[model samples]
Each structure stands twice: as structure tokens, then as C-alpha cells.
Target chain A: MKVPILKQGNILIATIQSALTDQDLISLKDNLSHQVIQHRSHGVVIDITELDVMDSFSTRTLRNIASILKLRGADTVIVGMQPDVAFAMVQLGLTLPNVKTARDLEEGLTLLK
Target chain B: MEKDTESEPTSSYAYNLMKEMKLDEEEILHRKAWLEFEEPDVNRLLELNDMAQGYATEVIESLYDHFLKFDDTKKFFEDPQVLNRVKNLQKKYFLRLTNGNYDDQYIQERIKIGSVHASIGLDVKWYLGAYGFYLRAVGKRIFKAFKSNPEKALESYFSLEKLVYMDIGLAIDTYIYQREATIKIQQEAIRELSTPVLQLREELLILPIIGAIDSQRARQLTEQLLHAIRDKRAKVVVIDITGVPTVDSRVANHLVQTVDASRLMGATLIITGLSAEVAQTLVTIGVDLAKINTVGDLQGGIEEAERILGYHVTKSLEDDSK
Candidate 1:
């Protein structure tokens, strides 16, 4: 999985590639938690358009990442979930706490800025 | 040693040879033929079939009569036309099962019937009780018919039990499938309809509010809008409420929370679509619009935004003056 990081001004954007499986989620939580603390970043956007599916484990990890970032005073936004995947996640009763979803990466990046 | 003419008929001899060569062949053919015609077992199944059909009819009639005694059940059956249709279909289903088809298609139909009953919110307990009574009545009838043949009577009872179990299982599966599908559709609709109220755009979060504001929808809108503002790191948010019919106190409170939430995330919230009547209603209701940026419409809000950002709307006018 490729984790693309871009920094423009005060906003830090991370575009996650591949499906957010359990292992990926753990790595993401660890990496993001470290980055938020290290940079004292106020805004973070995670683009997940490349991901096709998100199971319960992935959703929990995203929630964990958001909560940890919130503790560090950084706000997190999740973007690029396909409509079908979004519907399935909602059906499964999974939601990322304190994280907002956007239609695309551009919109997500624009919001972070 | 015997002459050809003195021997048994040539056809009879050939038949005997074929039978000896393929003894099981005749049984296989008989089974195949039975399947194609779906003939009831003359010796055992026929009597039980009639008994099952009669029992099903009696049970279904009694169940309906029982339902009519209760107000809730009676209310569901208020439409006489629908009730009659269901009753007629139930009769037909019993007849079909008793006809002894027992094919895959018949099994599927039986399952569908069970599922349909479940979907209509039929009292499962009542249905179970009624069905159990019917089954017992049928079993008694079969047992009486085979009073002299104990082994055959037991076999008949077991077969009937098996069929009932299979049909009930089919019904439950169908019911579960229908329920899950319905929930999935509703969830999707909620998500799709709520999308516009939580979108992030460049330099601003734009929430195009439409339709009547119910308390539930208002709360959902507020949460989504706030989450969008926080995640987008937006400095400004434009909420266009042109399609809103009227605002109540609860809706007003939700709007206040939305604005506060945006501010907490370091974003300014701009409220648009203040018609004369709405503005008057707000004042009458003692809902203060102070501390909230109220614009007459989207265009005015945009111009105000341009001014706040220190951008000249008419660069051509500046050039002409020079």
C-alpha cells in the first residue's frame, strides 16, 4: 500500500492506496498518531478513493485514528469512499467517529486547506 | 430337447431374459416415471395427503377467524379485498401441497408463502399454535387409517413431519432475506439524501439545505455539517436554506448548534435564504439572528464573501478608471 503525503501550508494530506485491511489500519493508526503529535498538525485529510472495500476492522481503525488525532488537537477527514462501499458500511453499522467523508480527493484536499 | 413350437412363447422368454439381466432397471424406470407424473404413493401417501390438505384448510381458516377478534390484527385486515385474496391464496397453497408435487418449484412456493406471512407482521406465535393443532389433527387421521399397519403408519407420520419442517425453514429464510433487504434500502436512501448537507468545497463548506426541516433530519444535518467543517479545515461555511419551508424552535436550535460547531472548528458560518415571512417568523419567535451572518440569498452571500476576502469584483472598472 502506498501512503502519499503532501503538505501545503498548514494542512497535511495523506492519500491511502489499496483496501484498508486490518494490518493496514494498524499501521495507519500508528503512523498518523505519530505524525499528528510530531508536526502538531491542525488539519489532516485521508483520501481513500483507491480503496474498494472497508470491513468492520478497517472502520474501527479509522475511528481509532480519528480519536487519537482529536486528542492531539488535529481534525481528520476521510474521503473517496465509493457510494456502494459507503452504503455497505452503513448497512454493517460502521461509522468513523469525528471523521467527515467527502466525494473526492480534490474536495478533501481543498477542505483541509 | 423340446420342439420350438412346444416351448413357451418367444416374447415371454425374451421378457424373462431381460428381467434377469437388469433386475433393478425396472425399479429405476418406475421411480423416474413416478417423478415425471408426480403420482401420489397409492398405498401410503394418498390418505395422508388428503389428511394434510384438510388440516391446513381448517388451521388457516381458524387463524384468520382468530385474527379478526383482535383490534390490531383486524386493523391490518381492514381491507376486505386484500383479506379475501390472502384467504383464497392460502386455500390454493394447501391444495397444491396435497396434490403431491413435492418438486423444487413446489418447495420454493411453500417457502415464499411463509416469508410473505412473516413480512405482513403476522403473529408467529398464533400461526405456530394453529399449525401445530392442524398437524396433530392430520397425524391422528393418518394413524386411524393405518390402525392395522403399525409400521406403515409410523412411516407416514415421519414423512409428514419432514415436509412440514422443510416448508417452515424455507419460510423463515425468505422472511429474513426480505427484512435485511428493506433495511439496506432505507439506509442507502438516508445516505444519498443527506449527502448535499455535508459536502466540502474549496475555501468553504457548502450545505444546500432543501425540504421541510424535521427534528431528526435537522439533527443529522447539523452533525454532518459540523463534521464537514472540522474535517475540511474550512474558514467559511455557506448554508443555503432556500428550499426550507419553515423553521421551528427545534430546527432553530439545530441551526444554532451547527453554527457553534463550525465556529469551534475555526470556521465562520453564513446563513442564506431569509425570505420576508421567515425573517418575520424568526423575530416573532424571539430567535436572534445576531452573531450569525444572515444573507438575503446565495448571490449576496457570495458578494459579501468576496468583500471579506478583499477581492475586487470589478477589475474592469479599475482598469477603465486608470
Candidate 2:
């Protein structure tokens, strides 16, 4: 699934609507990275409220995306992690270390500010 | 009948008690055989059933009269309607005693009766006492009816005694089984009630930990807190462990993991209520507490959370004589 990135002034929003395969995530990371630099967006919010079953690979990808965006001078705030999905990840001992997270898009935007 | 045999056993507690007691047909028959109740005994009970049918109502009434005279059993039959209903059931039970086909169906029915008795809060002492009264009442009739033949009466009475004992055994099993199920359900409810996540403010949550933190309860608490963090959109969490009795290495590890997990979801977890003893235990155990944010007490933890959330509390000086 191609994640559509919406731009609002200097910030970018990417809402994930369904489960994405590894290739789709990699493409999303590449596309997001490219867009961050092209738009010179100061902040990016990746909304995962609709995504269920976030395995280790996705957690690593999001962490990688955050660090990569940091290098490009754009902050990343992962938003809307479902309770069950977060529980499973923590149980699996997987964590998005050194990454900023928010409850929802509104909160994410506020945090970016 | 075939459908009932297939579907009912799987769903009914009585059938479960049967399995738990290992009272399958072979086992039941083995018990009868062990009691020396053979084919001749079955025939003897059939003959006694014909004689007992005439006295079933009389025997049941007298047995109930005995029950009503006792304080413990009398309380169960306070209402006239209940007494009548039970009397009818007792009569049927009395007739079935000698009706002779002691099959799986019979055992299942006995277990159902046993479970009903258990759920109604009828003490086993009362039940056993009632059984004793019933046997004595029926024995009096048997002795009166067999004035001409004592040996035949003895054999018939022995057969009846064996069948009643079997019924008693099955009923006791169901009582124990039902008690165990009730205890298990209560334990689960207690465990669920033990962990509560409270939302103190917008983007702030508090969890007061009490008692022991076994691995199972720790896991449950972690799951509940994570869900609360998401639902409440909490950015700060204050975990107060004042009621916790001990801070063993295992418990310290669980606390550390919980703090880390909450952080992963973008919520800062502040651990508070670490008594001097617990702090000493953690330091003595050499647990890496560097990642954990600790406050001396719950109030301090809440203050710390408020500080992180950009809130300041100011004390007003206008209190005096107003």
C-alpha cells in the first residue's frame, strides 16, 4: 500500500490505513525520506492508529525512519499506537528507543510545536 | 436420547463431576461389584421396589418430619410451598432407590441433585443426617414387611444400602467440584480487580501497586497500564509502590520493564513510594536503576509528572482568618 503524505505548511502527515508488508514499509520510508528533504518539512507525523500487528521489523523501520529524518533536520513523531499492539511489542522486548511518540495526530502536532 | 447423550454431557457440570471423580460406567459397576451387589441383589431390589412403592409417601413424609424437628434442616423448609415441592421430589427419589437400573443416566441425575444441594448452601452434615434418617425409616418398613422371611429382607436391605452409598459418593464429588470451580472464578476476579490504572489528569495516569508482584500479576498489570496509557492518551504515568511489601530482584526487574514499556509508548513513567528498605534492597541487589525515574513518595511523583507536563502549583497566602 502506498502511504499518502499530506503537507500542512512545514509539517508532513502520513496516515497508515492498513497492514503493510515489508516492501511497502521500505518504500514508505524511502518516499517519506525523499519528501522530507524536498519539502524541507520541519516535522513529520506518522499516524499508525489503523495499523494492527506491528512486528519487530516495523518497529525497527520506524526507529530507522526517525533517525534518518533527524539527519535531514526534520523531527519525527509516531502517533496512535494501539494499546494491544504496544503491549505485544513491549512483551516481545521491542522498543523504539530514542524516538518521539504521541497519542494522536493532534497531540503529535502539539509535540512538534 | 442419543442427541442428549452427545451434547448434554459436554456442557453440563454434572458430567464434568462424573469425569473428575472417574465414575465412568465401568468404575460405577466395579464399585457395585466391590459392594457385593450382584445380579441377585438387583433382583432383590426390584422386589423391594414393589413393596417400597406402597410405603414411599409414608417414608418420605416421616423423613421430612424428622428434618423439620431439627434447627439446621428446618431452616431450609421454612415456606410451606418449598416443603411441598421438596416432599414431592423426595418421594420420587425414594421410589427411584429401588427402581433397579443403576446406569450412567442414574449417576448423572444423582450428580445433578448433588450440585443443586451444594449451590443451595445445604450443609453436608444435614444431607448425611437426612440420609441416615431415610435409611432408618425405610428399614423399619422393610423389617415390618418381612416378618415371615428375615434372610430375604436382609439381602434386599443390603442392596439398597450399597446403592445409596454410591449416590452419596457421587453427590459429595459434585459438591467438591462445584466448590473448586467457585474458588477458581473468585481468584480470577481478585486478580483482575487487583490492578487498576487511574487517570489523574489529561495526559497523566497513576497506578498504585499493592501486595505481591508475581510474574503473572506483573504481566497483567503491564497489559492494563499500556491499554490505559493509550486510551487516556496519557503522556505521564506515576507508579506508586507504597503498598508493595518487598522489592526482590525479580520484582525490581518487572518494575524496570514496566517503566521501559511505558516510555516506549511515549509516556514518561515515574516510580515512587520506594520505602527506605526497598531502595536499600535494590541498591544491595545491584539492579541498574539508572533508566528508572524515582520520587520519594506518590505526591512527589505526581509533582514530578506535573513538572514534566509544564504545570506549576503555587501556594496562595490568603488563607488566614477568612
Candidate 3:
């Protein structure tokens, strides 16, 4: 399913709903990167509160998206990562090195500001 | 009663249980052989089915009467509806004894009943006592029914005893297994509670570590801190390890990993309460502490965290006004 990306001022907010297949995540990465350059957005917040399980591929994809956005001059702040997901991610040794994270969209925007 | 045409879904429990207990069909057959429960025993039990069904209700009522006399077992039947349901279930259980079809389905049913009893915190002693009461109640009825033929009555009683013992063995195993599983879950919860991540202020969190840091506890500590950092939108974190007893290479590595994970989440972590002994241990162990931001004490840690968040601690204006 397509993740709806909303634009607010100079920031792009992508709210993920339910489970996403690898292909959907790959498309989201492509779409987000493209939108970052087209909109000349200064920051992006990828909300994953609705996502229950985040496997290795999605973790790697998120990190990849952050790096790709960084190259385009847009800072990425992953937000709304559930506590259980964070625990599982840390246990699996998957971390988004050098990437910024926030508690929610409001915090993500404030960090970007 | 009309039999439901739909057959029960085949239970893999019998197979799973065999694997768990490290037993095969030959072992099971050997146990039955040891009990002297051959085809003749099965035939005898089936023959007693009609006569046993006649006394099943009376046996169940007397069993419950015995239960009601004791406060320990009586508490389970506080509600009349529950008592009725249980009494009906007991009747079925009693009748199934003589049904003489002890297969995987039978084992599965016994396990379910055992787990239920275990989950409800029923003491094993009470259940064992109930079994004794049940045996005597049924034995008396069987002996009276076959009074004209004493040899036939003894054979039927032996068959019945063997089946009851089999049921008892399976139920006890399930009870022990369920109890162990519950204990393991409780231990995990206690370990998680041992590491608490407290939010010190807006955009700041504090983790006060106490006790020893095993690999499991270290992992749990890191997980809890990372989650708190995200939940609190913490820009800075102060971890106070004043209560920690030791600092091995493993614990040091875990601390570093925690600092790194927090950094990934855009939170700066400050380690505090590093006593002279722990500092010496870290240096002696030669752990690379380049990423770890440490302070001398908890007060210093909180102060550093405030400074990171751009908070300047100033004296109250009332003091100057006075």
C-alpha cells in the first residue's frame, strides 16, 4: 500500500499504516527521496506508530532513506517507533547510525526547527 | 444426546508431548505392558461402561460433597453456575473412563484439564486427594454391580485403575510444565522491572542502575533506555551507575553500545556515579571509552544533561528581591 506523504511547511510527514511489504517500502524510499528534492523540503518525519513489526529489511530501508535524504539536504527524523519495536530492533543489532529520531511528529518538527 | 457429525481436529499434542518427554510409541506401549493393560483390559473396561454410567451421577455428587467439606477445594464452587458446569464436566470425565478409547485425543483432553487446574492455582495435594476419593467412590459401585461374579469384578477394577493412573500421569506432567512456564514469564518481567528509565525533565531522562549487570540485564537496560529516549523525546540522558557493583569488559561494552544506540535516536547519554574503583576497572580492562560521556556523580550528570539542553540553573529571584 502507498504511504501517504503530507507536506507541512518545509517538512514532509509520511504516516505508515499497517504492514508493508518489501516492495512497498522500496517504493516509499524512492518516492520519499524524489519528493524531498522536488519539494526542496528541509526535513522529513517518517511516522511508524501504526507499524507493529519492523524486520531487518525495513530497518535497512529506513536507514537508507535517511542517508539518501541527507544527501539531498533534507534532514530525516524517524518518529513514533513503538517501544516494543525499539527493543526488538536493538536486540537484533539494527540501528540507524547517525540518523535523528523523535518521539512523535510534533517532536520531530521541533527538532528540525 | 446427538453426536456432532464433525470430527475433532487431530491434536499434535500427543506427538509434541512425546518429543518433549523424549518418548516414542514403544516406550508408551512398554508402560502399558508394565501396567498389565492389554486388549483384555480394554475389553473389560468397555464391558463395565454401561454399569458405570448408571453410577456416574451418584459418584460425581458424592465427589463434590467431599470437596465442599474442605475450605481449600470448596472455594472453587462459590458460584452455583460454576458448580453446575463443573459437576457436568465431572460426569463426562467419569463416563469417559469406561469409554475405553485412550488415544491422542484422550491425552490432549487430560492435558487441557491439567493446565486449567494449574492455572487456577489449585494445589496438587488437593487434586491428589480428589483422585483418591474418586477411586473409592467408583470402586464401591463396581464391586456391588459384579457381586455375583467376584473374579470379573476384580479384573474390571484393575483395568479401571490402569486407565486412571495413565490420566493422572499426563495431568501431573502438564501441571508441572505450565507452572514452570509461568515462573519463567514472571522472572522475565522482574528482570525488566529491575531496569527503570525515569524521565527527569522535558527532553531529559535518567536511568538509575542498581545491582549486578549480567549480559541479559545489560540488554534489558539498553532496550529500556532507548525506548525512554524516544518516548520522552529526550535530548539528553543521564545514566547513574552508582549502585553497580562491578564493571567487567562485558558491562563496559554494553554501556558503550547503549550510548551508541541513544546517539542513533538523537539523544546524548551521560554516564554518572563512576566511583574511583569502577573508573580504575574500566581503564584496567582497556575498554575503548571514546564514545561514553561520563561525569563523577549523579548531581554532576543531571547538571551536564541540563547544560546540554541549554538550561542554566539560576538562583530564585525572591532571594535577590529580599
Candidate 4:
């Protein structure tokens, strides 16, 4: 499914609710970048609280989306990552070094501010 | 009756051993294997019980006399009353060794004898030396009594030799088993002591890790850190590892997991005090410790924590300095 990107004033919120395929991630990346440029949003919070799995490709896509959004002058914070997911990600040697993280959506918003 | 789970404080040999603890399967099996190998004639040995009883006092008295002669051995017998009580028990043990029940109860009693010696910190050399005295004393007595019948004396001597070997086996086995059990308990104690979370200040904490950080210890570190942060309401934690000598990939992954988990708890976790060697090890493994703040030592980490605390306090009155 195409990830929903919501706008609240000058900020954009994208909550990934389902498992993402290769094409879904590409579309989601394009969708987030397109919405950030269109609305010229200064802050972005990508909430993946509902996401249960993230392979290397999805992790890379998420990192790339954040970097591209950064060039567009929108600060991005990924929030609500599960502890087990973080544990698994570290074991797989995927620290997502460049990506910003927060405990939840509320914290992510505060960090962005 | 329920067997004795706790040790008895009694010095009396009149202590009812039947009411005591049952032998475990391994002890029973071990004794059975020795009995099979020795093929000791319990009946033949029992027949010599009367002959053994005649000199039981003489055998034990000489054994204690030998113990009192050596400086190391004499120290163990300093209490005259305790010595007398132990001497009486030794006399009875000499008689019962040939009293003929090579049953489970006999095996348990033999094991108990070994445990008592070990518990008293009696040197194994002294123990085996005492057994040696008993063997020679009994053999000398048997031969003296049947000097005219060389064939009969030789038969009895061979049977006594087998019994002494079985006794040695039981005693040495218990000594080895007790030593092994001691090491296991010490290891468990070390594991608990090693994962210490030292609180440096009201807001800052330090876990000065030493030795190898195995997965078990690393897991313990994560849980303890999470609890300490929440309970102490710590703003920052410094995981100091100057004492830790090496870090493999497995250890690196566990450390990363701990860092991630601590951060999730909303504590600004800083891995501080890495030596040059440790820094090289982490880089060699390609551990992506990116974006996570790290300092060279505990002092630098505390300074960083103070800086972070100051920045937060200035930004908001509701922050940590409360």
C-alpha cells in the first residue's frame, strides 16, 4: 500500500502502517519527497510504530528518504521503533547511523522542533 | 523419615546415620562400579571383624600418635576433647569397614566420611596417610595371627588390599566433587559482582566494565542499566570500558544492543573510556557506533553529561536539576 503523508501546518507526518514491498518503498520515498517539496514542509516525522519488519532495502530507503528530505530543508525524525526491531537491526549490523530516532511520535515532533 | 538436608553439629558417633540423607544416583553408581571392579569378599572380611576389633584401639591410637608427631597434622588435633571424640569415631570406622554391609547405606556412610574430612579442611595427604597406616597395621596383625598358615594369610591380605583401594576411590571422588562444586559457586558470584552499575552522581551513572563482555554479562548490563536509569531518573549513563581488554564481533553486537536499549529508555547513554586497542578492535569489526556520543574516559563523559544537563536546564525550568 502507498504510505499516507499528512500535513499539519508546515510539518508533514507519514505513518507506515503495513509491510512495504520494493515498489511500495519506492513510491513511499517519491511520495514523501514530493509532499515535502509541494508543501515545503520544514519538519517530517515518519512513524513506523505499526511496522513489524524492515529488511536492508527498506532501511536504506528510509535513510535515503531522510537524506533527500534534508537537502529539501526538511528535518526528519523516525519514531516508535520497537525494541526487538532495534535489537534485530543491531545484530544484522544495521545501526541506521545517519537516521534520527525518538521514542514515539510526540517525542519525534519535539526533537524536530 | 525425611533424610537430613542440613548438616548435623553433633560430634557423637552415636548419631543415627539411617535418619540421615540418602545417597544420590551418581554416588551410588560410582560405588557400584568400584565394588564390581574390586569384587571384594564382604563375608571373608566380616569373618576377620573379631580379629580387627581386638586391635581397633591399637590401630586408631597409633594413627593419632602419628598425626600428633607432625607439626601440620598436630594443629588439627589441638582440642583434646574434639580429638578424643574423633579418635573414638575412627575406632568404630575401622571395625565397620569389615562389618559386611556393602549396601547403599554403607556407600552413603563412606561418602559422608569423605565429606566430613573435606569439610574439616583435612589435608588429603594426611587422609591417605592415615589410610596407609590402617592398611599396614591390619595386614601386620592378620599375618602375625596366621604366620604358620602362609596360604590363608596371603588370601586375607589380598582381600584387605581390595577394600583399601575401594575406600581410597570413595574419599578422593568426594574431595574432587566438592572442589568442582566450589568453583561453580565462585563463578556465579563473580558474574553477579562483575555487572556493577556504579552511580557517579544523582543524574549521571557509570558502569566501569572489566574483563570480557560475553553475551550473558551484556544482557545483564542492558537490563540493569534500564532499571537504574528509570529508578534513579538518570539523565546520562557512562559505560566505561578502559579495563575491558578485548571486543569480538559478538561482544560488539551485544554492546550495540545495550546502547540501543538504554537510549530507548530515554537515557543519554555514552560509551566512554576506550583504550587505543579497544578503539582499533571496534573499528576493525566495523561497529557502526555513529552519532552516539562517546568520550575518552569517565571524567570526560561526566563533563559531557554536565554540558548536556546545562543545555537542557537553560532551555527549560522543568528539566533535571530538580
Runs of candidate 2 exceeding 4 Å displacement: B1-48, B54-88, B100-112, B125-170, B177-181, B319-322
Error of 2 at B201 (Å): 2.8
lDDT of 3 by residue, A51-108 (tens): 8789999999999999999999999998777766766676678867667887677878
lDDT of 4 by residue, A2-110 (tens): 8888998888999999888899989988988888989989989988878767788988898899899999889888877665555556657676666777656776788
A44: Cα error in model 2, Å: 2.7
Whichever of 1 and 2 has more TM-score, that candidate is 2
Clashing pairs in 1: A111-B232
Please list the residue runs of candidate 1 whose C-alpha ends up more than 4 Å from where it truly belongs after superposition: A1-113, B1-173, B197-201, B315-322
Report the error of model 4 at residue B9, Å. 4.6
B248: Cα error in model 2, Å: 2.2
Lowest summed lDDT across 10 adjacent residues in model 2 chain A is found at A89-98
Candidate 4 off by > 4 Å: A1-113, B1-23, B35-40, B145-159, B200-204, B210-223, B226-235, B243-257, B260-267, B276-292, B306-322
Q: How big a share of the true inter-chain contacts is recovered in candidate 3?
A: 0.27
TM-scores for every predicted model:
0.41, 0.76, 0.58, 0.65
Report the C-alpha displacement of residue B133, candidate 3, in angstroms. Answer: 20
- TM-score-based ranking, best first? 2, 4, 3, 1
lDDT of 3 by residue, B1-322 (tens): 0011123223464456545654456756776787777899889989988988888888888888988999988888888877887888788888888887776567667766765676677878887888888788878888898899988888888888898787787778877886787799999888877988888788888889999999988987887787777666787989999999898999998888787667655678899998899999999989989878999999999998898888999887776655
User: Which 10 residues in a row give candidate 1 chain A its minimum summed lDDT?
Assistant: A82-91
Q: Per-residue error at B129 for model 1, in Å? A: 17
DockQ of all candidate complexes:
0.09, 0.39, 0.20, 0.16
Full ranking by DockQ: 2, 3, 4, 1
